[model samples]
Target: MLSPSPNSSKKAFSRVALVGKFHADGIEDHLKDLATLVSGLGCEVFIEAETATHLGLSGYPTKTAQDFAGSIDLVVVLGGDGTMLGIARQLAGSNVPLVGINMGRLGYMTDIPFQSVKDTLPKIIAGDFEADTRTLLDAVVLRDGKEINRALALNDVVVNRSGISGMVELAVQVNGSFMYNQRSDGLIVSTPTGSTAYALSAGGPILHPHVAGILLVPIAPHSLSNRPIVLPKHSVTVIEVVNGLEVIVNFDMQSQTNLQSGDKIEVRQSDKTIALLHPSNHSDYKTLREKLHWNEYPSTF
Candidate 1:
């Protein structure tokens, strides 16, 4: 585990929000402790509406994640990676900086573990943490070359079928150049930050968040030669539905839309970026080895 950054030399007043899985045991206690910890550092702590009810603290009187992001100076997410992703997608257009505190197993985005809260809190409250900015993707679906639906994803945009009969065929292209006509259950266009998510499950490469690239990995490719490819971050990729099969498009984990044959999805780097509060970015390779146990050696001595 990484150590926390030290507290800031100057005091600062900031609005902070806590997003957590209050259903988890001991989390309420931790929330209270965390709130008090930051409050003592001259920051105002805010809670989500229902989460406050669960914790018996003051309800925030708001429901949407945008409410918190639009109001606060910083957002603190105390759950697993899923929770952080959920919050990230919700606050996508709002451009909120997120600080993820891990309360679950195998958290890559949620770097600060529950045990490290005491050390991490003081520094984060004092604005001593490092900030890593990760860009998002803007994905829009079109039918007959007419606009239909649009969404933003911090992770990846997935196009898949719920049916079981035949594989979904996707015509993949990058900036008007044909990549391949792929036959698979789905297609994943993931950001480097998302390389560890569903893309990784589909045999995609693990890309560092700082890497300026996007990944297109096929899910169960029909041809043996179809391999995952990384594209320049600024490249515009296009995917069209083929094979006359019905499919669904997902923006990160939210916003699902149905697409028929001839529907097109254009993906590219979103103009905005998401800022992450980091204790340090010096050792993600270490995280890959330690937290994930990437490639361990047997006793050689």
Candidate 2:
């Protein structure tokens, strides 16, 4: 249970949007229930177009993620962290706050459980919640000195070999300063918000979400001396494939693009931020303890 912040006023969320993972089991029912709940709170509900189509729903107004930019006040995401990450990237720079309802194995970003949605959402609607602003990374891929593709990520920008099963050479630089040249499977450039995701699995440090730093973790480095390094939030990192063998750049594990030998992948902090709403009782340490199964003892103790 969460109590409203002392300074929070009873501001209502009039326009809300519902987004969920496509084809997820039981997602239709959850979407229907959430729409009804939001309507009961005297708010208008808009469902994402793809989600509506998957659920066979038509009555409620449907809007594309991009179309909801100025119209939707808040977006309620139902699924795992991956689902939330997808929505977060779409809603980036829109300044729309996101509320996650957990329906996955590990729900780090999606803190609210499905059973608690009915209770938790109402409080959030009444402006009785806390907002945690997280930084986003802007990743751009340059080929032949021309901008090829760009995307925003809430987690990390990974540069790895695509089809070939061998190590690729990558020369890394930070703000024009040479960092290192490594032969490895890949490199994970993560924001603090992404420290616990793939970065942690690659032996990177677990950075608190509030930490103002970016992490560089090499994936399967050939040399044991290569280690994770944390850089300032404002620093720009450029990774050039020195000896590319069909490489690729992945953004938050949601979108990816193939890279060439001379391709340059630049990662930097974006000016936009994501506002994540959480219950007042939310604790990062508790989430870590439960999700990671840490410090559990035997019953006889």
Candidate 3:
């Protein structure tokens, strides 16, 4: 029911990668709807090859997220923000602009509403879009100076106690300066983009995405006096297990790795970044108000 932007050009690009998690209820139908819309726009729609079998889609060449990312100019992700994260990880270093259509809850990453795609898609194809270049964090676990596990997150990285009881002592440092040694449930080191996520849930404040800073929030400190602190972008937060107890480290609420006592964990902004495609002039406050219902006052009309 919406029209393309006035300046849309038909010769922009002819190929697209439609990525989504079709297993969720009602998602398969949404994928079909998206494909139809893309087709109507005159672009050749290629479902991520591997996703074909799961979605039971036919007549289109199926490809893995990796393979499809290599051949497409744009990637349209369906479902929620988490689904987009899964797909975007595959497109890292590929420089393919990603558009996320929110079909899930708390879709901070996938901020676009499903119904708005009618107008949104056209604007994107015409290159009438904005890009948010988000820095990714890379965490590498070392076992006696040898690389064990390495991963990236658009959100935060957490290191916490394994069992429900008892507190773990964490030695915190920033750029080689010692901060504190505290006993708490865990610790969260989040980027500005992740400030509103789990970090907020653990009593951290919301930071505008443009802020070149990181948040170091302690989760339920045993002393009750410890509070969250913001550090500069050029800083590095190094965590060490001072008490020689085993603990778990979670990356972006997805994957995890366990670091034994005496192991050192270093976290820093990655040289790599994820580029998100926005529709231009989009304000961070606007999204916060809309998504969080900031104006939903109790007694307002």
Model 2: per-residue Cα lDDT at residue 22: 81
Each prediction's RMSD over C-alphas, in Å, is 3.7, 3.7, 3.1
* lDDT per residue as tens, model 2, 208-282: 999999999999999999999999999999999988678899999989998888899999999989899998888
| lDDT score, candidate 3, position 108 | 79
Local accuracy by lDDT, each model = 0.79, 0.89, 0.79
Of the pair 1 and 3, which is ahead by TM-score? 3
Residues 64-165, candidate 1, lDDT per residue (tens digit)? Answer: 465865577788888877777777776766767888888756577788777877776667666667788887889999999898998888899998887775
Positional deviation of residue 52's Cα in model 3 after best superposition, in angstroms: 2.7
**lDDT (tens digit, per residue) of candidate 3 on 1-301:** 3334454456355788788776778777777778877767777888886567777887656667767545888888887877877777667677777888887564777888888887788777767778888877777776677777888877888999877647888898889999999899899999888898889889999988878888889998988789999888877788887763558888887888888776777888887777888877666777887777898445653
Clashes of each: 0, 0, 3
TM-score top scorer: 2
Which residue window of length 10 is worst by lDDT in model 2?
1-10
Off by over 4 Å in 1: 1-9, 53-64, 68-70, 93-95, 244-246, 295-301
**C-alpha-based local distance difference test score of model 3:** 0.79
Which segments of model 2 are wrong by more than 4 Å? Answer: 1-11, 296-301
Question: Pairs clashing in candidate 3?
Answer: 49-62, 49-63, 50-63
Cα-based TM-score, every candidate: 0.87, 0.93, 0.89
